[model samples]
Target: MQHPLAYRMRPRNLEEVVGQQHLVGPGKIIKRMVQARLLSSMILYGPPGTGKTSIASAIAGSTKYAFRQLNAATDSKKELQIVAEEAKMSGTVVLLLDEIHRLDKTKQDFLLPLLESGEIILIGATTENPYITINPAIRSRTQIFEVYPLTPHDIQTALLRALKDKERGLGNYQVHLTSEALELFTTATAGDLRSSLNGLELAVKSTPSDENQTINIDLKTAEESIQKKTLSADKNGDGHYDVISAFQKSIRGSDTDAALHYLARLLEAGDLKSIIRRLLVTAYEDIGLANPSVCQRTVAACQVADNVGLPEARIPLADVVIELCLSPKSNSGINAIDAALNDIRSGKSGQIPNSLKDTHYKGAQKLQRGQNYHYPHNYPNDWIAQQYLPNQLQGTQYYQPKTNGKYEQALKKTYDRLYQLQNKERGHHDD
Candidate 1:
């Protein structure tokens, strides 16, 4: 039976695994667990083809335990029961449940007892975040480890190994791969070693051999095998959050290029809702008060994006993203509100001054409510200093505006002048 190149090239042991040194490297958590033969239930999660299944297989191989593989999406509850029964009979078994995030409550309930009894060392694999998708009972019983994407160098190493190994790889063929071809494979696969190896196999198998009986793979052959880069992003997975975080940070850092790059990625992935939400948050949190108009523009852009959708939607999104990236950054407004909130939460709220209280409804002027209230419009500069905040917080300043942008600079000047006049007025009254 001929297997796929990726399957044939699956790492048989820990030493053969190409990437994820953090888990499989010397003295690491997984390595120690394997060496000590002290395995437990765990979930391996990350973008696909980062060696999650390979790691589970390696652990079982090194420990010489009975290994069983099942897909949570297609496998029936009876199949899980069979595995659990076998674990009970054999003392212990290692079950590799792929797409474990899809495990239903029925199967989860059945496996919980076996997992608790220590008869089955469950090695669940998922591309989604376990915390988000998996049942709480199952998640609480397992430790989660993230498998990162393989680096280009790591993928190259795997490619070369597959080409050189005769038993499980293309070593039987006299193949010559040019550097350009190899670079294309690595670049097009986007750190997914499986895709890279699959493309390499296709190039070698599909290309014709020369008179010398040597299969020559050039850049054109590689391109034909894998035409486009496979983006390592899942809209419902951790990659979604990661890309959004990068996009926001880039805008906050005022890196227009990087911000645009991440925006293009999100657009390519068709993550419209996340993009819209993130743009609004960035406008307020990162660009607040620096250019207040940016927030209004961002909201308008979001509306346009929702109405127009896709291909054309990218325009308004790009406009807002670039505007935010280039705008002066400030968080003074958010900080000021947070400070006020903290004081309220800590019970620092004091009684409102009688002059500022509402006296519109049937007061009859008996309570003297709002009697001495000084309307700012009645004073010069449309500003008058009377007690507005609670008496306990009357003099405490919360909004300390930054002079990062021209708009904020004008505000700072006005704020300082108003307070200066208020202090003078109070001093005169005291005299």
Candidate 2:
């Protein structure tokens, strides 16, 4: 049985590995480790087709060790024990465990002794972050290295190499790929070399050779082989938080276009809860007092979105997103509260003013709690000159409203007037 082109084109050694120059390049960490023949157990992590498995395979080939492959998702404890026994007999076996994050306690426990004894030189591969998914004991035993996505140029180089290599690749077939077809493969896969190679192979094998004995693959064929790349997202994964962060930042930065783009991505991913939550957070955290009405509108929009889920939910979501993107922004409300909380946390919470203390309880008059308190409603403008904060924080201003929007501007005027009246009263009393 013939293996897939992607498998056949796997880099046999470190030298043939196309991407991840940071790790496998000359004098790099992995290369140096390979050259010194002092290989240690390590975790290789990154996006798919970025050569996590290939790097493990290349390292095994370079060191001339007995290489064993196992999938953590399907392989059982018995299989792991078999690998461990082989490692014990071989003195040192390079075990390439794919989806290493999926390895349960049983398999991990079975491999721990072998790993510690230096019999199994484990090279674990994972698409998820090892720190988050793998056992901490296993993580501590290995040096973690992240293999980034292959660059377009790097992927293109791999494709060309596969096309010309006859032993394992499609060199025997005369395949003519137009520039447009090549672009479709390169750009559409988004730096996934495995997808690119498989698409190329499908394009070549499916199309029959003409009378001239040549297979001409066009742009349409390439697209059909590797459909348009779907946006890489996991609603419960890092991509979820990442997109929401981008959406909020775009709105804060006043970039309507970017905000809409991120919103569209989240909506397409069907993460309605995240969209509604982020919109509410962005409204208060970013728009804040600068445009307080935005908070109300955003809340209403969220209600609408919740009532009518996606497809139609996107309408209200777009409304809120656009309004927020164009709205005046302020962080002062949150900043003021955080500053006050910090002060309180630092043990600066002075006693509440005597007059401001609650007087509804029994024996309140005997304690003289409300003795000097003047009702503001009894005075003009329903306001009175009195200390609302403790003595230590009497004159300390927390909410310094900005004049960015009309609402805050009017608020600033009222706030300034109250302070002015209080200062005048204090001056008169001092005289």
Candidate 3:
């Protein structure tokens, strides 16, 4: 009996691999490496089901070097030793290690000698970022090539082949997939080829056989087999753009649950960078003044992400999310400053009114720049009244403090004193 559609669909050669034409196409660097027998130790880093393993296999088949396989999560140091000895005797060996990041520091140290000796050309495969996950020493020794998710055209081409090919595919099933079904499969899988094909096969098997045997994979069946059709983040398109907009709005609206749900969708769809960017924006723009610390922490998280990269960086982003959501809400101060800026932009260019201008300049003395400019600290409580803006815009309320937290309380006291001084100054002007 044959295996499942996904299992059966594994590419037999580099040519059979879909969606990575840049790496496998004629004149490509990797193809050149394979052809010239000049392939170096390298890492294939990409998301799941993007053919990291298959790419490794293709390299092995095409190259003249002896190929050895191991899983870092399961293979022991003793097994590594055996492989090391084999490669030492074999002259040139291609060691293809899957989930290479799982190898602890000690285990990775075992391979350094062989790699340095030129006995083993290491090929590491990782879904997580190799730069952060793999030992830096090991990563430094190898060329890193990033593999991206398969495009819809690539998936469509593969699916059509599977439905038509007789030898190693499901041509016998004679499944006629509707356009709607194909769309659901592509969107639901989130660029995971194995997932899309598996869902396709399941949709076909579940449909009752009829004369035409036209398998229509409706949304309901797609959802049932896929367990959950988490909406994809449009990493590029308008739909993805809209969803993210809604997600950010939820956060700004203080709808914590809705924000979290949209966050989950982005995360599930592998929209890590975009999620971090939005969180950073919200930390400052939405939660500012109310909890200034939220912005600081969010920016720090972004830095951590930049320094360390994904999988590990994900934790910091998660921390920022919780802190922003649970932080006491306040937008009065944020709105106030924005309103004030609009006033400055729309109004006629105002002068540096004589009362507020600098007194140090020679001409400024004659212009009466310091005529009424009061040094607030010289007066009682460092609370003397003075106009900071142009005379016409005096007492223009820009930042209205919110009473939600300690910051606002401090602002309220400061504002009251400032207002009193402004009124006193106005009375003097009236006199």
lDDT of each: 0.88, 0.87, 0.76
List candidate 1 stretches off by more than 4 Å. Answer: 208-212, 227-232, 293-323, 343-370, 419-431
Cα lDDT of model 2 by residue, 206-280, tens digit: 999999999999998898898554344567665457678899999999999999999998887888998898888
* Per-residue alpha-carbon lDDT of candidate 3 for residues 116-145, written as tens digits (9 for 90 to 100): 887888889887767677788888889999
Question: Alpha-carbon error at 50 in model 3, in Å?
Answer: 1.2
Model 3 C-alpha RMSD to native? 13.5
What is the TM-score ranking, best to worst? 1, 2, 3
Top candidate on lDDT is: 1
Q: Candidate 2 at residue 68, lDDT?
A: 88
Point out the worst 10-residue segment of candidate 1 by lDDT: 227-236
lDDT of 3: 0.76
RMSD of each: 3.3, 3.3, 13.5
Which residue pairs does candidate 1 place in steric collision?
none
Candidate 2 residue runs with Cα over 4 Å from true position: 255-261, 300-327, 343-351, 357-369, 391-393, 402-410, 416-431
What is the overall TM-score of model 1 with all chains considered together?
Answer: 0.86
Give the Å shift of residue 336 in candidate 3: 19
